[model samples]
Structure formats: structure tokens, C-alpha cells
Target: MTSDATASPAGKIALVTGAARGLGVEISRQLAALGAHVIVAARDRRQAEGTAAALRAEGGSASAMKLDVTSEADRLAAREAIEAAHRRLDILINNAGILIDSPDGGTPAERQPSEARESDLRRTFEVNFFAPLRLTQTLLPLLRRSEAPRIVNVSSIRGSLTHLSDPTSPVYPIRALGYDTSKAALNAFTILIAEELRGTPFKINAVHPGWLRTGMGGDRADMSVEDGAHTAVRYATLGDDGPTGGFFFLDERLPW
Candidate 1:
């Protein structure tokens, strides 16, 4: 790993998975707007190119690369592409995820357990947990090359044990067994990784972007994609002194 020992996040290079659309696209847009050279990586080359084109139209340093988060080869190719162009990766946002088939308004949490399927559980964890873990491990050396690196995992309030336990909490009643449990597993990875990197110049954190009105969140959700990407962008560009091994919503830390 090359060392700057003094580089700040400004003018740094960033790679965001699933950056073709939705929250991932929004986060890439915001990060590039802040002067970072952002790599938009997604499974669909066409969509990734479209996003990169949009960013370039807005006068940002952005590029598109085909990256299927679940594929190790795709992950390595993305890393090679980034390294060839920028030499080091300063920010990583593991935002690629999927939600299995659930009804439009969503079945109540109690009812969800009954309706849950085994395939749904496996698929959700495959995308939400395994992929991120694999991608992060593959790109860690790139992250270590930076002077002050940041890793932001887009998690959710539904993953919070505290919120899930408290009967008075809003999220207590909103669990989708597979998706919720997968995010909780992702949250565990965030904490463990952060602890492992303790005392380093890197900050790793999980952010709950609130309920967004994206394809996954449905129309009645409170936040727009614009607002939903804010916490993610913040977490990605956090300072050297910023918090790690923690869950956040904007600036507030949430209970485990």
C-alpha cells in the first residue's frame, strides 16, 4: 500500500457499488459533486454508463465500470480499473443490495414470519451480507493505500436490535425476516471490521438512510433519494477523527 500520510478526502478517488441507480446513484452524484473522482460500478454496464454520462454532464470526475458485487472476478476487475486510473481508492460505499418479493404495502412483522420463504432468506443474505464482505476484503489493500480512508455501509433501522426489541419503536413493527436479518448481519460486519481497523486512519460506519421512496422502499416512504443519500455521503467523507464501529443516521449514533 502506498502512503500519502497526509492526503485528505478532497480530490480522492471513490468507488461505489450498485451505483447505476437509486440510493447508490444518488450517493455517487453527491460524492462527485464534492470533488471526488467517483467510480460508478454496477452489474449493468449500460446503466453504469448512463450514470457516468450524467455525472460528466454535471461537470464531475466520474467513470463507469461493470461490477457484479457477488462475483469475485468482477470485483477484482473493478479494483484493477480503479488502480490503473487513480492508483488508490479513498472511499468505498458497499450499497449494493436487494429485497425479495414482499407485498406492496408490506405484511406486518408478525405476519411476515409465516409468509417468509427459505429462498428469500438465502438470496437476501447473498447480496446484502456476503457480497459486501467479499468486496471489502478484496479492496482492503486499496483502502489501506489512502491517507485517510472511509468505508460506508448503507444499512437500515430495521437492523437495529434495540429498535426491533422496543415495542414503542416504529421499526419494531416493520421487519421483513430475510431482509431485516441480512442487514443485521451486515451491521455486525461493520462493527467487527471497524474494531479490526481501530487506531487506523480509516473510519467505517453503518448508516440508516431512513425510509426512502425508491423501488425497494415504495412510494409512501418519507425521504426522497436526494435526502436518503446524505448520510451515506457524510459517512464516506468522514474526517480522520470521525467515529468508527458505530451505526449512524446523519450525525446521530443509533443503539445496537
Candidate 2:
């Protein structure tokens, strides 16, 4: 990896999952902009390399790797690549995710008893809950090598059980059990990992990027991709004294 032409990535490296397009792409771009040599991870080697190429052309240090978060082989290879190149990973942005397409108006809780399918629930959990946790666990040793490690789980506001339960909450407009519940599980992982890492220099946090205009976010989203990425970037680059095990959107502490 080449050194940053402008700012030094503080001599750190970062890996962002699902960086082929949408929020993942933007997040990888922004991290590179901050001077970190980023690994633009995606399921497709072609797209991943293309993204890394774009970054390199623009004067950022980056490389591409195939990382299907659900597959152990890919994850292991990604870790090995990072270890070989940087010896340690300073930041990890678990930005890959999906939103199951549901019928308009959502699967209301009242109707969930008969409408929700086991397969739908399973897939959502696999991507949103288990995947992030598993990746973090696999990369812990490499992260521990860094002077300051940061893990930013790209979550959603709907993931908050607190907000979902509040009838008056702004998030009430959107509801999908498969997606929402999976995120809730992810948030729990974030809290537990933060607790496990307490007294250490590492920081782990969940962030709500808000509704964004991505393939999953649809067309009605109020926020741009740049706006959605702000919180993730902030959490990824927090100072030594920054809050850990916290839920946030931009700078605001969110209810979990």
C-alpha cells in the first residue's frame, strides 16, 4: 500500500465490507479520503478491484479483496491479506447488509403471526446479526495489534428496541421484523463486545446512518449517502477517549 499523498492514515489500515456500491462504496471512499490504506471488500473480485483502482487513481492507497462475510474461507483470506500488508487493522466498517423486500405498508406486528416466513427471518439474521459478530470475532487478534482499534457496525434506527416500542417515535413509520430484529441482535453484539473490551484501547459502537437513498433505502429516503456515512466515519475515527458500547447517529446518542 502506498502512503497517503495528503494525510497519513495515521499509518493505519482499514477494511470495509460490501464495498462494491451504495453505502459500502461511499464508506470505503471516505475512509480512503481520511488517508487510511483501505481494503475495498466485496463479494465480487472484479468490482472490488475496480473500486480500489478508482481510489488509487485518485491518489488514495487501497487494495481490493473478495470477502463474502457469510463464508469463513473468504474472511480468513481477507484477514491474511491484511496481516501480510499492514500487520494489523486499525479500523473495520461492517457496512454490508440487506433489506428483504416486503409488501407495501410492511408486515404489521398484528399480522406477523401468519405472514412471516421462517426463511425470511433466517436470511436476515444471517446477514445482519451473525455475520458482523462472526467477522469481528475472526479479526480480533489482528485488531488487538493496533495501537487504537475501532469497530463500527453500520446499523439502523429501526434496530433500536427502545424506538420501536415507542409509538410516538419517528421510526414508527418503518417496520419489518426480519430486518429490524436482526439489527437489534447486532446492537446487542456491539454492546457485549464493548463490554468485553472494556479497559482496553479498542472502541466498538453501533451507528444509525439514517434512511439513505441506496438500493435498500429506496427513493423516498431523506438523507444522501454522504449524510448517512457521517456517523460511521465519526465512530471509526474517534479519539482515544471516545465513547464505546454506545449507539449514535452523527454525534447524538441514540436509544438502544
Candidate 3:
């Protein structure tokens, strides 16, 4: 791995999943602005196109792709498309996630851990944990071809066992068992993969995008989408010296 701190992303290729809107879109915009050819990937092709078009309008190199991370077919198609076009994927931001335990457009409720249904837990894990893992595994070959490959798993502070165990922690009161557990699992995957790829140039880390006012974060979130995307963007474009197998919020390392 080249430890060049001044590395540039000018000729790199990146893919941001669930980038039709919210933090995903912001992360795509930032990566494109940094001179990478970014693929705005979402389940909705039209929405992805719109986001990619907007990024291009801002003088960035970007395109759209349909990627429903949970589907095996979509995963294969994404790999094929990237292989045909860029031939390598330099950066991957696994930003697609969900919070299904919350009530649908209604008042929030305190869901007990025991009250979380098996179906809800399974669906949450499918999207939040398993999907990213499957997609990353599928793209590992392309990522391996890059000189400096990076994988940023967009996690949440709510997933932190350290925070959950502390009564003083702000996330202590927020108990969505399904979402929290899935993110925790995602973080674990980050560590496991980073360790496996330790001697290589691949930099993989789990990041907390901070609580933002997105569809999932609800209206009362403390941060903006732009601010929320900062962590993922920073780690996505990490220099060769950047840390791997870690959890970070912005530049600050978080307790695992």
C-alpha cells in the first residue's frame, strides 16, 4: 500500500448506494466534486438519474445505475456494469440502510427489545447488514484491482454498545432494537473484513454519519445532510495512511 498522504482521486471510480436522496446523494456529490467518476446508485433508476444529472450540472463526473442491494440479480448487474465501464471500483460507500421498526408516518413509540417481531428483525438485517456485505463481496474483485481501494460502511452511533450501556449517552433513550442491532452487525463486518485485508491497500472502516434530518432520521435530527455526509466522504477518500478496521464519527474515533 502506497502511504502517499497527498493522493488525489482524479482518475478514480466510486459508487454510492441509495444515493437518490438524503445523505447518500450528498456523499455522491462530495465524492464527484473530489474528481472521482461517481455512480449514483439507487433502487429507483429515474431518481438515480436525476441525482446524477444534478451532480453533473455542478461540474462533476457522474452517472446513474440501478442497484437494489438486497437483490442478488441487482448485485450481479452492478458488478457487470462497473466491470464493463470503469474496469475497477476505487471507492465504495455502503450507505443504504433502513429503520423499519419505527411507525409509518405516525407518532414514534418506545419499542421494547422483546417486542420487536422476528419478521421485522429479519427484514432489517436483510437491508442494513446482509445487503452491504453481499454487495461488497460481489465487488471485491473490482476493488482489488484499484491502487488504493476504500470501503466506507455508513453506520450509526446507535449501534455502539458502549453508548447503549451508558445511561448518560444520548442514544440510550432511543431503543429501536432492529435498526440498532443491524448496524452493530454491520460494524462487526467492517472490522472482520478490514482485518482480513490488513496487509493490502484496501481501507475499510465503519462510520457514523451523525443524526441528520433524513427520512430515516426523522425531523428532529441535530445535523444537516451535508454535515452527515462528511464522515463517509472523508473516509471514502482516505490517504494510504488512514486507519482501517475502526469506527469513526468525523475525525474522532468511536468506542467499539
Candidate 4:
């Protein structure tokens, strides 16, 4: 952990996981554009480096780290690397996730809750819920060293418990059991940790970036990736007066 005296005077330092492409890369791009030294993290080193290289080509300050969010070794190594170079971390985006089952794939019976495999449930939670939780814990020390540390958990509207239970809600009819529940768990984490850090300059939020036309979201989804990246970027770069421990989509506060 770094002391306040050694904190970088440069722009923010941000690490975004699963940033090789899609929503992750978009978030990294926007953060880099905002003058943050964005760290593009992915399970594959080549892909992560490629994404970071592309960002540099666009004149953004960026780098790449090989990080499989699910691995403890990767998480600690990332913390060490960032601490060595930057001392403090201004932003941490827990963006790595999985949607093993989707509405667009498999037979309806295959995707149904009753037919869902235990392996699928565990895998989904491993990536979506547990990975971020553990990674955040590992990096908390570095984040605390910053003047205003922001943590954004890339969540989904499907995580809304109110929507899941309400038949009239837009998300009510849709069900990807494992994926949805995992996001819900992530949302819970955001609330809990935010409360624990309430008096500090930390702002932690679970943001839904809308139904993006990405690999996980599928082509039938409504929003563009550009628009989908907005909410997370907004929260990730929040002001001192910004709300924490909240679920959000754009400016709207979502229900638990």
C-alpha cells in the first residue's frame, strides 16, 4: 500500500477486467479518453496487449495485463503490478463476466431453471459474482491510497429483484437463471461494501449498461455498445457528491 505522499499527480489510474473487446474495451476506451491510464485486463495476454495497443494508437494512455479474474494468482499479481507502477488506483472496473446460458441459445427446456445444470450455476457465479468480489478485496489497499477511489461493478438490469418478481416489469418475462442470479449477488456486494466504506471518498456502484448488442447480449438487444458503456463510465468517474451503494442505469436508480 502507498502513502498519500507518493500518490501519483498524473491523471487517474484505472484497471478494467475482460477488456480485450466489447463492453469492457469500450469502458477502457472511454476512461482512457478521459485521461486515465487505462489498464486493459483479460485472460489472454496477447489479446489484452492488442486492445491496449489499439487504445495507444488512438492516443490514449493505456497498458495491458493478463488477468483471469477467477484466479487468485492473477488477482494478486495485478495488485502488485499496479502498486509498483502507480502506487494508488483511482478506478477499478469489475467487468469480467459470463452468460453461459442465453435466451438466444439452446432449446427453451435446456435453458429453463429446472433443467439447468449445477455446473452452469457454479461457473456463472465464479465469473460474475465471486471473481469481482475477490478481486476487489485484493485491490482494496491500492484503491484506498487514491484521493477518490471509484469501483464500478458492471451489472445488468436482469439483476433487479423487483423486476424479476414483477410480471409487469420489462425484465420479468426474461430468465437466464444462473446469469441473473449471479448479477444479483454482485449487486448485493456493491451495497454491502459501499455501506462499509460510506464515510470515505470511495464510490462503489453496480451499473447496468443497458441491453447492448454484444456477444453476451446477443444481436437482438436494443442498444449500441457505445451507449451501453455510458453508465459504467459515468459512475466510474463520479464526483465526490455522487451516490454510492446504488444500482443504476443511466440516471435511473434501479430496485434491489
**Index of the highest-TM-score prediction:** 3
Per-residue lDDT of model 2, residues 110-173, tens digit only: 3352577788889978888888889999999999998889999999888998898899987675
Candidate 1 local lDDT, 123-212, one digit each (tens): 889899999999999899888999888999989888898888999987777767887888899999999999999999989999999888
Q: Candidate 4, clashing residue pairs? A: none
Better of 2 and 3 by TM-score: 3
Model 2, global lDDT: 0.83
Q: How well does candidate 2 match the true structure in TM-score terms? A: 0.92
Question: Each model's C-alpha lDDT?
Answer: 0.85, 0.83, 0.90, 0.87
Candidate 3 accuracy as lDDT = 0.90
Candidate 3 error regions (>4 Å)? 1-6, 103-110
lDDT of 3 by residue, 1-256 (tens): 2234335677789999999999999999888888999999999999999999999999999999999999999999999999999899999999999888775212243568878799989999999999999999999999999999999999988889998789998887767888889999999999999999999999999999988888878787788999999888888888878889999998789997
Q: Candidate 1 local accuracy as lDDT?
A: 0.85
Q: How close is candidate 3 to the true structure, as a TM-score?
A: 0.95
How much does candidate 4 score in TM-score? 0.93
The residue pairs that clash in candidate 3, if any, are none
User: For each candidate, what TM-score against the reference?
Assistant: 0.93, 0.92, 0.95, 0.93
Q: What are the candidates' C-alpha RMSDs? A: 4.0, 4.4, 2.6, 4.9
Rate residue 18 of model 4 by lDDT.
95
